[model samples]
Target: MDTTLQDPLVGRLLDGRYRVDARVAVGGMATVYRAVDTRLDRVLALKVMHPDLATDAAFVERFMREAKSVARLAHPNVVGVFDQGADGAYVYLAMEYVAGCTLRDVLRERGALPPRAAFDVLEPVLAALGAAHRAGFVHRDMKPENVLIGDDGRVKVADFGLVRAVGSATDTTGAVLGTVSYLAPEQIEHGTADTRADVYACGVVLYEMLTGAKPHSGDTPAQVLYRHLNTDVPAPSAVVPGLPAELDELVACATARDPEARPYDAVALLALAREARAALSEEQLDAVPPQARAQVRSGAEDRTSVIPRVLPLPVEHTSRLPAPPDPGPAPGRGPVTVHRRTAFLVVAAVLLSLGLGTGVWYINSGQFTRVPAVLGQTEAQATQRLADAGLDVGTTERAYSDVYERGTVMAVDPAPGERIRGNGTVTLTLSRGPRIVKVPNLKGTPLEEAKKALAAEGLAPGVITYAFSRSVAQGAVIGSDPEPGTERSPDSAVALQVSRGAPIEVPDLTGESVPDATATLQEAGLKVVVAAERIHSPEDAGTVAAQSLAEGSRAAKGDTITLTVSKGPRMVAVPDVVGMKTDEARGELEAAGFRVKVEKTFPFLGDTVTGQSVEGGTNAPEGSAVTITIKGL
Candidate 1:
């Protein structure tokens, strides 16, 4: 088979207006071509389902539904569908024609794009996906091939609603419809897909764009699928030596095995991609040499003047169609005729019939149908109301609201009572309610105090406690309750604590003179009292000789104790007993309470005192000592 053989659809008229020019791309179920709209004289892309697939009623119904679903989508980055119709054996969709390479083509040509360039490319795709997600459509099979970059550097995402048909078990013709390298972990394992599934695929696309390699791979599709299920995806940095930490983190986040680990949906991923694009480091920018940057600038130049290659269509045996009439002409190539007269007549008849039918439609189109007001109503109510009004309730969307209750209608497009064409769509936005967040208060306070304040504000306080002092005393309320100003729920509790005075220990003042101790005790807020005591020495007179209580005892306040002071010792005088017998002298000294020290100097041999040196009972306090002397014979 000659690869150069042209597709039969090329230059063929479709629906009597669109003329297929060149094949652009072919997928499992459809072949897309560049076409010229004769009626509008504009270039358009046409996707025609394979005749074999269209033969199946189920596939045809799904294809038509998918077309309708995607046609409802309106976004700058998304390719717009113009019309959908069945012409003979062909079911084709006229869509927007973008004249740029697919991101796949770019990837094949340049192994890996710069990290910045990758994000720049992905930003629009994510935006498109986000819009679809918000509209409740999931682009389950997101990949670089579905992305197209225009010569003007505009990015447009294609292939929105066809994924359902591709994933259907009945549609399995053994052709792998999806790019295996990009399937998410759950998409591979459970074959379950959702908005987050799309996010995971987008992450894989970004990874390949950044590192020039898929995060996971195997010898076969099944192996690749297994890898997605079992293995952890390595970061882009691991493949390319020096990718930005943030970009690496983003890739990891996007390709996470757990769907919940990835961004909630494309909208969140789009936000992250935009942030990554803006935050590209100077080093990454500098790494792309001026020459390489120039190539990127120059590669973006228009090359439409040189005819690009047309995508090849699957070879099939052609069945002969009725011949068209030959028009007589006298050019160098004899009578110029294309097809037999019968074929031309049939074609003319079809065109004529369509024109008449369209004219009838135009006249009938003047009929007015009022779109009922369905704002602020539930989906079921809105649908019933629209049905009652002979209008169709089309798209339903969930959106955040500040005033409206959840599940209630936020708004509707093509406002009520407006005249609209037959089967016009009614876009409804459902309310999710305003965002509510618990208040966090930390104001005019120390760290601990602030934390308590926040807790009282109904927010779980994060402790950032650090010792701080203000007019507030140490370890006291620096200032709290609720910080100076913060929004909090009514009747919320605010934490508070009073300050504790500085630490102190009682002073011990034990033994000291009464005068000195009095001064010391007075300074320490203690009073001193004197207790009576007798002293033996004059030097010890009137001093604090003893205390009623021992020292070093703990007392709180106003405790009293007595101290004993000293008076001088009393002196006793000597008593005299002379010229009497020894027993009589001892008796006299004994009566005076003085022990006698007697010495006998008498010449008489008897043991008796003859004389005394001092008289008895001398003036003295208490007992006095007496000295005795005796005369010799």
Candidate 2:
């Protein structure tokens, strides 16, 4: 279904300027919508605060103040916020629109990545954060979902100014669950965040990239937060064995449970990252880990990553690099003829110097050989090439590949140009074409559990839709697209329909007592909360004045309905204008917050008022009507 069409803002002009087109994403505090600034004729992402939140005048004021501060922070990595405004009940921030997925999406699709690919993403992210940290801003909430990767391969940090709108921890389970996964121990234990906190999150991100999984897992946000407060992040190599020790050290240094033990800031951490990367050999950088899942992507796969997402670098190590010059001959040119007598003399001279000849053979030929480049070659062609280099073919094997064609040599031992023993055999692994997996049945599974199921089968969780279902429990998956047992390539997205339980019609609770309203809502399987502030309304004092949801609107069971109580109509003091001219008295009454009705005794010529309906110096409701009697002339 086109959910955007159902949104009241879609197709409606906001602030008589911005035209909201489509809903892009939803967060706990706001919903991001693709919009256009009609005045400037530019597209932007509109992050509109939830209506319930916008109701708080104090909160909106702080939100705008923080947004203005963030807008002053000009950096390429951070998402640009242009303007902040409110239209009626809607408060929004117009930000630069980036059309792409997030790091969360990439991780969901491809679990572990080769070290080179992981660094390509991590370095740029750290650089962006370094800018933020230096600017005296801390993104208290740093998660993969906030890392935007554009189609043009530019990485940007999002939701910078919005985090301060709420504290580090929230009451919502969904919000806390995603946030707690990346929080540092200090952030979890004390709810304090500084630049080092961001470094901790980056370490967790690196670990996830290296192992294709989070360092910690639990059934609830409390469990995850508890682990963060107590547990130290493990080395990536612990999961993906044989991972470089340098990478392990890097993760350990950044993810140290003690804040003082970690890097001071993202800039410091970025320097450490560079050092770690520099220490890695080409082979270590490009070696795909056992946990790295093959992706069904091709031709600039990093188009989805906003960061510098170049493909995994080819493995090229400088082993046996000290050999003497052996530029034997140039290829594709005519060879000059050599005299037979000259060649015979040279061979005889070498034979006469037996000790020197043996040393020369060992240095140049017998001791070492370079593995010839044969990636993406036919199996037969690779075998011939190996033979030409005086190397033996040890084993022939094939694995499914998304990039290479079947029967082509996709990988080789010792990689290209790496040193191999002169008598060693090179093992060639051929491509078996693309792989496919059947989607598992996930009906009746909880949402979080379903995501795990998809990950287990090397598939990624896709867009989720919520619907009201009677039979299925709330928060449980009703069904999935492509159905169970449907065949799909690895990392293919699977959309799910989750149950919202049965829908309930929200009843009007305005004018009711607080206890009565709460009892009524609780009986209807809905949660109720009274607003923190009371607003002045025509309704009686201490009575329900408004609700978050309109009367008769359909809401899912357990949906929270907020009630706004009234402090009653405002009272204004009446002015002492008795015995004055009728026109003057009428004007004074109206000015003092009263509707005026003048009555002239005869012929309507009595200009002077002897008395007024409201006694002078009396208080009345601000908008109440007041009648005046004029004495007859």
Candidate 3:
């Protein structure tokens, strides 16, 4: 059944931009959907917070903050965040959609993977987490389900909704945020998460990939949490025999109960993992334990042949028996007598044929010899090793490799120790050293295009710092470290400096307080410099009245903005404009900075000032209003 057809969100447009196409997966806090950005005409994954969780303002804010943080990461191995917004009760984050299965799916279908396959997935996952850790973000929840293996064989870390800055306080009052099976001891106990917490989770994932089961399992989540806090993760070899000791050490170092004992961060753990891989021999690396479902399937013939036979089949007799009629003929002649010697010979002959057939089958197909380990060895060395094992070299191939040296054996057919006929041949694949490429000149290229260029050259985009440059266009690359034309190893990160464009328009700050004006200017990428001298003005004291640069004028980033603060209004004496014609009094008072009013008696009208609110010589604040009273006489 197509369950996605029943989802209400399916076929609905979210925020009028993302057209939700299909429900991808549901989690405790959100439901992820495969959606297309109608406006941008691109596909992306939309993670909508569950309506219940969206109601919590704190949770929603944290979720959106996660979107912003992950968006800043910009790592190739990390899923990118495109946009974040809400449509009524649905708060969604549009993310880069990876069209492939999760690591969880691989484990479920294949059980324990071969060491090579396991490392192939783990390395990229670690790289992604390492980038996050270096950028001061921690993926609090790391699990097999969050590791996305794309159809193009790219591994990306997804679902960073629980990501938080390193050393940030976690919610200790309520339920923990991560899956219990992959939780670190510190996370389970105090609800504190750091880079080490993610390291621990990655170790657990690695263990699962090696053993086809989680390192710790319990009947309930609480039980699992308890175990995480009290018990240490067992070695993978404990469950899957023949696993290399180096892998055991790597898992142990990462899954240590004490966060202090584990690697400080994902990058440190990644280095350790690489070191372990380098130290392992091809035999150790390719060893397939009995627990591996793939190995079991590959050895199916051996298992099937080992089944014991319950009973032997009877041999067919060509000659028809003389039957009971021979009994009557026995009296007449010896012809009715059974030929016991002939019957015994016939039975022996049939048994001999069966024995010969069994011998031939064992020699041709059942008998086997183990393939010799020859990885990392030179072609000549590998050939000699195979010859020692009574095997011949069949085909020699060459391929580029970053890990293996040139002319060294990178891999072998049938792996290192799989069983094969004694006369079988092994194919050797030799390495051609690391792939190197010259960094292209990305100056003046758009930031996005520059990133793509780096990726095309097998390089990764590193920290991006922005600066104001008149020569370089806005949102374009200013330059890069290591310069252009420099050769670098594949997947090396190159630091980039992007242009923030021409100076920004400085907003007018008149009538705003010093702090408010300073903040407003800072937001526009301008620095504030308050003038020490105070000036009398109509504006309130401490308010900005004048600026060094005119309003609506452009100023470069970090440009100083001088602001003149206002003092209280100046005091001025009121002018007496009474007992004179209204026009004369108004003109005379206005000349002296005072207003005039007319007054008249009851039965007659007169254009003359009568009374004033303030005394003639009394001082009043400048720009303050003065009232004049008029009477009819």
Candidate 4:
């Protein structure tokens, strides 16, 4: 049965973002889990602090702050930190997920390494540490378990939990924060660590790699700590008889009991390692120690070289042989006595033939070949460069990378510095550039929902702005600046416009006098504009007749309202029509655009108009009413 099935956090979604899949490892401080970043659509290792430590607010704060600084320290060999947060009882860090085993796994599988293989692993580890040291961080916990070897053969340094700034107090609650086996003497005695402490641990690791065993053995961790504090790490040559002097000197220099005697930092040690490698010959570089274990093969070994595969020399070269017991040949053959001159000629001829053959072989296959470094180079450049070195370009693959530019080589197979056949094909993995995502249409979405939507799409919510939108509800997104469907790099900030509900309201003001309307509009925090020309209207003179903006229109504060003044009424000469019939008068009056009314003088009989209030044919205001009397008695 899988033990992870019983782990409480195995199936939990942490911080509403990381979906934990399975527990990867459990340490004293935290439990690491293989998880998916649901928001970013990527896989990441989620290291959740143990519940006991999560309760410490100061520790949690320091952990997150350190994580933020580590996130900014971006190097190819350092595992990347993408995010950090807390949820309920879980405080976690989301890191780049490396798909391979740790150096501890490698050491357990392949006992001791030949010099070439040991150097191959050591160089990258030192490079990573050198970078961290220069950047003012000391990885106090340097152990095989913290060195990650990816399936692609890349070496990455991980778990910066115990890492701290150069001069900070190097202990928590007065307890050392490192594995007992790899802690330096200073770390054990004085509770302080610096770049030199990392160097000492690395020296111990180097000794283990070259000798297949630690210098000191103990029944318990207490014994191990006692040994680290009391004794010095032994030279590899002491354990492995044929190990080279150069490596022994390196281990001795790095593991000096006094911090002042060790290399100042990993950078200085890396320089020394390179110099030591340069001084050794090919035979010494590949010398296999007697204690090095032959890995039992169930199947073909993994070819990628984070921890390299060391090939051993022939048995005759590695093992000692004894002289024959019976020195004399058959008695008859000895008495025969072969000619010395002929034997000499034959030996000389054979030597000459061997020399010529070696020359021919050297010409045919020039020399040793290694995969050339083509990282961050364009495909064309990498191909041409590989061709120049007599190596062929193999299959090319593409992967997204934030560190390398698009179309540039991101990784190589038979990776950089690994030996290869003269004509071996080097596989290239190119960068496809940072992942691009389309901004989602967030119009009409609630502010919180829109932010969540952006995060889900691998984008960050940028500055927020509030605007009045008649069509969009309050607290809902009015629109985005990039609009919608624009392509953007992941984590790009997107600005949002949220609705502040409908704008200011404007009331009707058409029939009010100019001064009165101006005051009304001003009281409403609106500006007023009066028309230059007055127009004849039903409203009295100097009163507002029309407004520029229509009634019920939406406007904001400080908006302008235009008013047109009325010119009272217009008049013209009246024409006599006293004798005209009431129907005729009515027809004429109606035709003239005047409303007409009739009044009967007596008992209502005649249709004739005997009198008119405004004499017939008079021009009144265009839409005014006129009255007429009928003679009837």
* TM-score of model 3 vs. true structure: 0.45
lDDT of 1 by residue, 364-456 (tens): 333445566555567888888888766776888887654456887656666443446656678888888754435443333454665565555
| Model 4 alpha-carbon drift over 4 Å, by segment | 1-3, 161-178, 297-633
**Residue-by-residue lDDT tens digits, candidate 4, 16-85:** 6676766889776788987766556456799888898888888888888999988988888899999899
TM value for model 4: 0.48
Q: What clash count does candidate 2 reach? A: 4
Off-target runs (Cα >4 Å) in candidate 3 are 161-178, 295-633
State the lDDT of candidate 3 residue by residue for 152-181, as single tens digits: 567889976454422222333222323678
Order candidates by lDDT, high to low: 2, 4, 3, 1
- Cα misplacement distance, residue 242 of candidate 4 (Å): 1.4
- Candidate 3 local accuracy as lDDT? 0.76
Clashing pairs in 2: 149-306, 153-306, 154-306, 155-306
Highest lDDT model number: 2
Q: Pick the candidate with the highest TM-score.
A: 2
Cα-based lDDT for every prediction: 0.66, 0.81, 0.76, 0.77
Whichever of 1 and 3 has more lDDT, that candidate is 3
Candidate 3 pairs with clashing backbones: 600-632, 600-633, 601-632, 601-633, 602-632, 602-633
lDDT of candidate 3 at residue 43, scale 0 to 100: 63
